[model samples]
Every structure is written in structure tokens, then in C-alpha cells.
Target: MSHRFRKPVNIMPTPTIDLAGPVAGIDTHTDTHTVAIVTETGKHLATDTFPTTSNGYQQVTEFLSAYSVVAAGIEGTNSYGAGLTRHLIGHGHVVFEVLRPTRALRRRDGKSDPVDALAAARQVLTGQALSIPKDTTGPVESLRMLQITRHQLVATAAKLLTLIKSLLVTAPVTVRQRYATMTTTTLVMTLSRCRPPADVTDPVNGTLTSLKSLATTYNMLRAQCDELDNKITDLVEVINPAMTQIFGCRAVTAAELLVSLGENPQRIRSQAALAHLWGVAPIPASSGRTNRHRLNRGGDRQANAALHRIVLVRMRHDERTRDYVQRRIKEGLSKKEIMRCLKRAIVREIYQVLCLGRPVRQSSGLRSDEFRALRSKKGLSQTQVAKKLGCAPARISDIETGKRRLSELKLTYEEFLKTA
Candidate 1:
């Protein structure tokens, strides 16, 4: 000590770590959340359970604050973990949607909240979690709510209509005879207006009362659905007018597509990614000699249904779509195969227009010279072509002159010209 007094030595304090690659994993439930913190090296630091309240979310942030979090993996981000995910996101945290452990993994590890949370953390640490959670704090969320409500209302109305029909089928002769000849709209109107006796003791009165109640409820639900439809249409048009303008694409189908894309469409990455997400992309199932792809049954079924709806409508109404169908059929592609091809092509077009920020050009899959040459060879006049296609002559003229955008109409018109 006497020797050291001659020259004092300064000791440096340990530097505080700003962040050490700590990742948080949360297994969220309705009432509580099981959270685990792990480091980059896959060391589980701590696991804790917190209530799913604002105070609890705050407490969780405080607990994780001890070690600055680099990222978070959250299970059920669209369900139970939604609130926590939003909270974490608002607090400037990078969050990834973590799928639940596979049954095989769960069987091996045994199941518990702490174990699941720890597994999630470790998955994040190991770079297993990849999907970014949907941001629900936007107009897209409002559209989703409206779309879901309308869907439920429509379903309920359909069930009610079915039940009413069933009841009438078994009703007393007089009641059955009265409704038998009425169309669905007339039946609903008549049933809703019926004034059954207060005493439901009689079978006729009981049936009448039931029909009245169900009809009225169905009408109400139908009205609500119409209102929701209007809202959805307005919102979708405001969000992406080009999507609505696509042949056979209605607001409801567009809404489903938007919901699947989430608030950030860029997160979908590529056209192929979008096609895969919507189940339009085929999955490879190839072997040594037989190389093949199978229908993808795993993506967003709702979006897939939307695409199917669009395809069905286009097949029935769009001139170009009909032409494609005929060509594909002639080329030995079955109806199902043709549908798949159309969906894939539509997805590609949508991706180009929406995600790639390309101007929404009419997808005229035709060369003007070839189309004109085919028409000239067939000796079909533009007016005759317009009449055959049930379109304006000006439309045909514009198509020939390249003044108007026509989506795939050339093949159909050309086919008509050849056959004429």
C-alpha cells in the first residue's frame, strides 16, 4: 500500500452491453403469455409467464429490457398473440411469426408453456422463424372485419333459407301448397309478412311462426350483408382500383386477396410467392422417372377460393378467357388443368400490376399483326366480328388499331375468324 501510494492506478469498469443478440419467444394464450429469452448462442436465459393485459405487456417489456432484445418470435400472432405482437411492434421490436412446434418435436421435448416459449426463442436464435407478422393497424384490417362479417351474415342467411325450405317441405298441406309455387324471393317475402296466431299450440301456427321468424331474420341478415358489401366495395376501390377493374374480380374477392397479402404486400416477396400463398402454385411431387407436380392444398384457402371465383366468372363471361379455355381443351388440357393454368397466369398478372408497381395494362395476349392477318385471311369484317363477340364495333376497331386495351381477346376473335 505504501508503494502504491507513489502512483495511483485507475481501474476501468466493465462496459455495459448495448445488445447481445438476445431474442424473445412468446407462447401466447387468452389469459397469459409464456415468454422466454435466449441469446445468439442458444442459451435460454429466463422463462416467465405474464398476464395478457396492458400492465402485463409493460412488465414483459421491462423484464426483457435487462438484455436488449434483437428480435422476437411469437406464436399465434393472428390469434392469441395478436395483442402482444402489436405491442412489441409498437415498441420498435422486430417480430417474426413462429409456427407451433411439430407433433414429432413436441413428443420428443414434452409439452409445457415454458418449453414452448424456450423452443420458440431457440428457433429465433437459430434463424428458424421467418414469416413476418401481419400488421393489422390499417384500413386493410377494417376491410377484413367487414369482409368477415359479411361472409358470416351471408352464411347465416343461407342456413336460414335452407331451414325455411325444409320446414315448408314438411309443413301442413295448406302451408306447403301456398309456398310450393313461390320463388325463393316471393316465399321469403310472403313468410316474413305472415301473421301467425299468438298460440303456437297448433302445428299450422307453429310452422307459420317459425317461418316468419326465420324469414325475417334472414332478410335482416341479407340487408346487413348488402350494407357490408357496399362498405367493402368502397374500401377496396379506394385501396386498389386496378384490382377491382380486373375482369371478373369483384370487391369481395379483391378484399380476400388484400387480406391474404396483409397490410404490407411487399412482404409477399415475389409473384411465385404470392401464387404459392394463394395455393395457385403447384407443388413438385417428382420421382426418378415420373416428374410431376400436384395441387397445393396448404396455402390460404380463402384466397384460393377467391381466385377460383374469378376464374369461374371469367370462363363464363370474359371473351379472352373463353378463347383460352377452347385452346387449352384443344391442346389436350383438361378443364381442371386449364383452370390451374389460368389461375397461375392471373396471379402473375396481379403480381406485376400490384406488387411490382407496373401500370395495369390490359393483358392482351395477342400480337396485332398476327390477329389482323388471321382476320384478313378469314375475310371477316370488324362489324361482323363485333356482332359475333357481342361487343361494340368500335371495340374491334380499337383492338385492330391498338388504340384500346383488350385482354386476351385476339385468340377468341381469331378463332371465330378461322371458323367463320
Candidate 2:
């Protein structure tokens, strides 16, 4: 009716609306993965399942791209989601590690791929998941692979050795007597060389044959371990020469630390983070009037073992560390407490070397200035001396300062002189 007298009214076309891209969450499995896409405002847009294969990865990424994925949260970045995490990062998407849903949350929300994936996305959007996945393409990855292989080999050898020992317990008296006084190496060699009788009907012959077979397997595994050890040693020397230079850190120990810390040392936020990661950080157990911290029984046990080894070596041979232990003992600390302290301290020292890239000062009996001059004369950096001696550079400084000796370097005075 208004159109009868009103001037022509202009109608404005609805402006185009632009919504922000969605974030993605992945629930990874061995053979397949469930992916959920959620809008910036927390609305679930879609859910899809894909195979855990190269082509599947490509297809998943493509599907996410269609929805304009801004970021992704992936559960088990170190395990099931490792491949996808790598792919997403390589494609320039910001990726965050989504820890497994807690038992409480799982019970409350129930569980399904889409549910978990949605939860992961929510965690990412809300900043609940903050861990940056490790770069798995570096030398550290190679070291990890080798370390895992070596560890398996070692475990297998131990199991085989145990079986052989059990067999020997019931073995023929002649066989037991022959191996009883022998060392492990000697026994293995002897058993491996035994000429078992061809008569399978005889118990002794059967026992001999079984022993030889076990011994042969043990020897082969040992040989493989040795080869792996050499490879690990070479790789460690190249990856971080400074690691092997620490007084108590051998190639194996250094390799373990490297694996624990990853290639990018900066991934360890701080010395405290490292301590926590290795379970060397004491947990506060104080309640009310009680003031105390208890041993942390979490984190990487392998890393804890590595730190414990360093503490043992230092306690046995490091004068300063020995003095510290004595003082702590005089202060009425128990051995366990002392060990905890030592592990924490050792973690600090290792953190300095690994994370901060600093040389650890050893109590080696040498003047700092003298070591400096000697290093200068030899055209070596603190790192070079440490690498060559398989001890920390700070130890080299200590040796030069006359506060520490060269003995811990596994080198005689003459060898030191030649190297210097």
C-alpha cells in the first residue's frame, strides 16, 4: 500500500559473510585415524575416518584444507600420530600435542573417535594442550632407533643367558662342572664351541646340543650389540661431543640423554623441566608442619637410570661430589635423600651442558689458566678437549687448575701430555 505514494526504496543486498576457518583434532590409531573439524566458535563441522597410510594422510589433509584448517591437535604425537604430526607440521600447520584424555574425562564424556577428536580440538582451542612435538628427523632420531635396537638385543641376550643358566642347573654334571667356574664370556664361548654328540637319544647329548644352540644365539646377539655400541659411539661423538665428555657419561649414557632430550635441546624448557622429565625433580610431600620432598617415581625411567649412574660415578670418584655427600651425611641426611640430591644436582649439571651448551667443570687437578693455555697451544676448544678425553670441558679446566686429575679421562699423564 505504501508503494502507491512513496518514492522508490533502495534495497541493499546482504553483505557476504565470512566465517573463520576451523581447527582439527585427530585421534590416531595403528591402522586408521578419526579426525574432527571444529569451527572457531566451537561447533563441530564434520568428522571423518582415514587409513593410517601415506595416501590416507594426503587425503585427510586435503579434506581439512577444504574446511580451512588453521591448526591441528594430535594425540600420541610420539606414537600413533607421529606420521600425521610430521605431515601436518611439514605442511606449515601449527600442531600441538594432545595428551590422552584423563580417566575422569573419559568416564564423564564416554569414548569414541569423534568424541576424542572433538575433545582434542577443544583442548587445542582452549590451550589445555601445550606441548610441541619433537622434530623426529634429526640425528637424535637415528640415535633413538639404534638405542632401541641395542636395548632389545641386550634384553634378549639376558633372557637367553638366564635360560642357559637354568638349563645348566639340571645339565649333566660334566657340563655344569665345565662351566661352573667360568665367567659369562668364557662360558658362552665354551658352550658355543662344544661338540655335542650326534645321539639325540642320550640326555647329555640333547642337553649339550641345546646349550650350544643357546650359546650360539647369545654370541650372535652379543656381537650385534657390540656392533651397535660402536655405531652408537660414533654417532654420539658426532651429535654432541660434549655429552660423552661429562665424567660419568659414556657413549651409552650420553646417547640415552640425547634420546631423552631430543635433537633440539631447546625443547627442554629449563633445567627444572629436565629434572622433571627424568624424574630427578623431587616432589614436595610436605603437609602441615612437615617439611619434606619425596623421590619422584615418574618420568623416563631410562633417563633416571642414566642420571643415577652419573651420581654413582661422581660419588665414587669426584672429590667435590664425595665431599658434598659427606657433608650431607653429617647433616643427617639418609643415603636415599643424598642420592636424590645428587641426582637433582647432576641433572642441573647435565642441563647446563645439554640445554645451555656449556662445558661442565670437572675437579680434574689442573689450573684453569693452564688448561686454557694448553688448549690454546693445542688449538682446541673446551669442547674438543672434552670430546677427545671423553670428559667434560669444565673438567679439562679443572684439570688445568690442579683441582682435578687426568685419571678420570681414561688417559695416563703421558697421554694427556701428548694430547695437550
Give the candidate number with the greatest lDDT.
1
Backbone clashes, each candidate: 0, 21
Q: In candidate 2, which residue ranges exceed 4 Å CA deviation?
A: 1-21, 285-292, 364-420
List, residue by residue over 7-88, the lDDT tens digit for candidate 2.
2111111112223568888999999999999998889999999999999999888988899888788999889998998888
Supply the global lDDT for candidate 1: 0.82
- lDDT at 226 for candidate 1? 87
Report the lDDT of model 2 for residue 196.
Answer: 89
Residue 415 deviation, candidate 1, in Å?
A: 21
Query: Please, what is the whole-model Cα lDDT of each candidate in the order they appear?
Result: 0.82, 0.80
The sequence of per-residue lDDT tens digits that candidate 1 reaches over residues 1-420 is: 001122211111121222367888899999999999988787878889999999999988887777788888899999999899889889887888887988998999999999999889877765643577888988898998898898888888999999999998899999999899999999999999989999999999999999999999999998898889999999998887788878778889999998887777877667777887888776766689966667779889998999999999999988768876997798788898898888988898888766776666655555555677777777888888899998888888877775655655655665676567
Per-candidate Cα RMSD to the true structure, in Å, reads 14.2, 15.1
The number of the candidate with the highest TM-score is 1
